[model samples]
Target chain A: MSNEVVLKFHKVQKKFGDFTALKDVSFEVKKGEFFALLGPNGAGKTTLINCLCGLTDRTSGEIAVLGVDPEKDPVHTKLSLGIVEQEVNFDPFFTPMEILRLRRGLFGLPADDAYLEWILEKLSLTDKKDVRARQLSGGMKRRLMIAKALAHDPPILILDEPTAGVDVDLRNSLYDFLRELRTQKQKTIVLTTHYLEEAELLADRVAIQNLGETIICDTTKNLLGKKNRTLVIETCEDEEVRVEIDNNSLDLESIVANYPHVKNLRIHEPKLEEVFLEFTKNPKS
Target chain B: MNFKRYSTLAWKECYRFLKVWTQTLISPVIIAVMYFAVFGGALGSRITEINGIPYALFIVPGLVLLQSTTNAFMNPSSSLIIMKYSGTLSDLLLPPLSALEKTLGYMTGGIVRGLLVSTLIFAVAAVFTGKIVPHDWGVFLLMLFLANGIFTLLGTILGIWAKTFDHISGFSTFVITPMGFLGAIFYSLEMLPPLAQKLSLFNPFFYLADGLRYGFLGIAEVDVKYSLIASGVIFLLLFAANFWAFRTGWRLKL
Candidate 1:
């Protein structure tokens, strides 16, 4: 990934009447990077996305997509990035092909049937392109949303829970598609999802937000490396015990020596899931 | 503004109504024909004449205006409300199309539907009254656009403001429908008492009906010049209001 920041949010805050949705959000995603935004329910993930996409106004702060502020230049920002909103927003009356064509025109892009067709094929929506969107299944609709986002072939892709209700198989296929987009197409991706495992598998870097504030943000490798590792000890009596220990602070040799009757012993690297739980569960820590 | 994008949005608006021709086109014509049959045929016999034009012929322009007005108001309002409720409005909101383009695109749908209904009603009215052409084609076309433009933009504004289907229907029923009826669709300003006539002058729909009536019959109770100017001003105001609504993302953006 290039060092240049493709997306940036500096002290973003949003308020709805007396209720604040985004308290203080700030982050940056580099070009060609797959950045995941993970948060619990009501953590202002969608609110932040709304502010970034110009769907809503932020009460205070700045957001820039490739140096163009969305508030000042919404058209440029909209043209630069394609967003798959958290909800299915396609018009059911329109066919996939019609919707895509309309979207292409809306973005002020030249007509390219071949490109749109390729997008359909990439999302496995080729056969369903001519059918009305309402008739499509839930997974198919989700994929169609992605296709619509890619209609303009934007440099950046921001998917807000793209696989919320999708089945495992389709979700896996979407992951592959997203990976291809990042790798082959060199598209910068900013994803917000409830599925931490999805983030773990796909995101190069992740940010965890809770109560409208970004609690932690770092590379997956760095975050996992910083977290305490787990040590599992299995005794000859078929009893097993797990202990959390920092690799640097705890002496592994001394811990292993304490288990003399151990039949099996293994050291486990902390998973992103555990790290996410820890940070969100105790953000102050 | 990109012409291609604006034209595409306009085409999409047209496509939306055309996709449901039975409700948008045919139903309005059927209702217009029914009104002509009941009001023009039955009522015309007793009324004989209005403003020196045959009663059936006098009511023809009013009938056309009435359908055009209702359809023009309903088209954009329902289109907007449905898109809002379904969350499909983001497709338009996220696009790079300018606010002016969006306003014109949506207004095009309502104007087209209104004109189509007017044409259909005029054709049907011609069969009964035997007048296919208007007295003044320029005035006819101008009134058609001004009246249609005013209501269509009103619908666009209401569509953005309305949160539910009830809000749209309620406004149509309580405000638009009552205003249209009191605007002299069935009778002339001279037919009413002096107080009612004064009240009729206050109704914007009265100017619309009178202006269109002058176009069809070359006769009107009120001066057609004032009606033309008033309708033009109203149309421009509504157009600006809609443009401002889209530009500011009023009620559309969170």
Candidate 2:
């Protein structure tokens, strides 16, 4: 991936009336990077997304999408970004094909039936292409949102809780599709999701935001590596115990010698969820 | 400034009403026909002439203006309110469209709906009165365009301001409907006493109806030149207001 920044938030602050939604938040997403922004409810994720998309104004600080400030050049900035919002906001009366055609026209892009057909097929929405959006199921609606976002073939795609309420099968397929977008298509993706496991599986780098501020930002491997290694041991007495050990001190020979009655031993690396919970649950950390 | 984007937005707005022609187009046409049947048929002979023109002929222009203006106001207001409520407005907002493009796109829908309703009214009037010709076709078309443009802008403002269905209905009920009736659609302002005629001057709709009437019948209570100027000023003001609203993202952006 190129080191060039695709998105940058420099000490951004967003205030609604007297209440601040984001407080001195700053981060940068590199080109062709699968970046995950994890936060609990009301962690300013949506507010941040809104500000990035020009749907909401920032109280202070600067944001640039592909080096273009959205505030200064919203139309041009929006042309490079595609957002799959948390809600299904499509026109109810329009069919999937009709909506895509309309979106393509809105972006001033020429019609390419092959691309449209490929997007529909990838999202498993081929059969529902002619059906009104409102008639589609919840999962289908979510996929339709993705399809609409991809319609313009924007360079950067931001998915705000794309898999919320989505079935496992569809979610897995979407994950695969997103991976392909990052790997084969070299598209930069910024995702905000409540599903930590999904983020752990997909995100190359993850940022945890809490109480409207980003507390931690690092690569997924580095973040997970911060926590100590865990060892789960099973003994002949049919007893199981989990012990936390320093990563460097985790030696299988030493562990077996220490627990002679051990029947089986397994080393466990801390999952992303553990690190996320640790960072968010303790704000001062 | 992209023609393709502007045209697409405009086409979508037009397509929305066209797709629901039964409610948007046919219903208004039916209501207009009923008005002519009741007002023009039942009372035509008794109230023979209004301002030197036959009562039936006089009301044709007024009814046409009334339907067109109401439609022009309702189209954008309801479209915006519905999109706002259904959370579908983000579709338009997320696009690379400029505020001016969005404003013109929405206004196009209202303009098209207004013209469609006006044409239907004229068609129905032709069948009944057998005379659909105008004194000055240029003035007639100009008045029609200006009148629709004014209401379409008003609807856009109300659509942005309104938060609920009741708010939109209330605007139509308390504001637009009363203004239409008081604008002298059924009778001439000259028929009223001196004081009432003076009070009628305060009504903006009066200018629209009077200007439209003068276009068709070649006679009006107000000076056509002054009415044209006033209509032009009002159109510019409404356009400016809508432009400002979109630019500031009033009630549209968070």
Candidate 3:
């Protein structure tokens, strides 16, 4: 990812009547970055995305997709961004080819049948292109939504739990597909998913939101590196305890003094899941 | 401004109804045939002719207006609420198309459906009455265009305003059907009492039906020019209202 910021949110706040959904959320995503927005349910992750897409108006603050304010020029904002919502929302009556044809027209692109066919092929939907969306299996429907989002080839793609009901094999393949898009096409990707492992495995930068606030935003390596290593000690009595290591320093004498009957010792590195829980579980920390 | 996007949405709406041809097109024609059988066949015997034209022939224009306008209204109304509830509205909303473009696109579906149904009903009317043709083709086309444009735009407004299927059905059952029945379709103003004749002046559907009848027979109870002006005004008003609803995203964007 380069220093060029392709998407940005500045203190974005959204309220539905008396309840605030997004409170003081601010972040920037650089071009070609795989950014994961990690948050608990109702933590304003989707709400923030809605604001960015101009689907819902924000109560306060600003959002810019590729240097253009979405509220000011929603047409331009939508033209530059492709969003896959959480639900399967393609028209059930239309076939995959018909849906893509309209999507291409909506983006003001020429009716390039060859390109659309290629997208269907890449997504493994070419076989099912002529079938109505309602007849497709759940996995195929999900894949069709992905194909629709990629139809226009927008520079930035935002996926909201794209692999929610996908099978394990399909999920792994989707991950590979996303990786190819990011590496080969250099498309900036923003993903929000319940599966922390997907985010950890794919994202270069992570932003954790809790209770309508962004608690932490940093690179995956930095967030995980900031966490201290653990020293797991096992006693002869089969008791086990953990000690936090600071700055990679381990005082063997102090550890031996503390655990006089130490039978085993091992060091453990924190996973992104652990780091994510630490921030969300205790936002103040 | 973007004709491609607008035409795409228009065709999408058309394809949606066409996909369910049994429900959208064929069913409405069947219902109109039933109306022609019951009203024109049974009732025309009692009232032989009204104003030199056969009773069945006189009711032809009204049935055409009814089927045409009703289908036009239902096309956008039901399609939109269904899309909204099913969450497929995002397909139209997330794109770069402008509100005006969306409005025109949906309106195209309604107008096309309206005209198609009207053509079929006219054919059925011809079979019963023999070779129906417009006495004033210009006025016939004008009345059809105006009625379709008006109701289609009204449907667009109600589609965005409606929150549920009930909202759409409620308006159709309560407001549109009543107005259509009382709109001088089945009877002329002269057949009613003097007070009722005066009251019919306020009904827009009366103007539409009367205008259509004038186009078919070159005769009308009221001044054909008045019907023309009223229908034109209603179309413009609804078009402006639809444009405003789309621009503000009134009930749609939230």
Cα lDDT listed for each candidate: 0.90, 0.90, 0.89
Candidate DockQ scores, in order: 0.83, 0.81, 0.80
TM-score of chain B of 2: 0.98
Cα misplacement distance, residue A223 of candidate 2 (Å): 0.9
lDDT of 2: 0.90
> Which lDDT tens digits does candidate 2 get at residues A216-265?
89999999988888889999898897888887765667766767798888
Give the fraction of true interface contacts kept by model 1: 0.84
Which should have the higher lDDT, number 1 or number 3?
1
Off by over 4 Å in 1: A248-253
Error of 1 at A283 (Å): 1.4
Model 3 chain B worst lDDT window (10 residues): B245-254
TM-score of 2: 0.97
* Lowest lDDT 10-residue stretch of candidate 1 chain A: A246-255
Could you tell me how far off, in angstroms, the CA of residue A156 lies in candidate 1 after the best superposition?
A: 0.6
lDDT of 1: 0.90
In the range B41-61, model 1's lDDT, one tens digit per residue, is: 898799998767888888888
Candidate 2 structure quality by residue, lDDT tens digits, B89-188: 8887889887788889888889999999999989999998887798889888899999999999999999999999899889889988898889898998
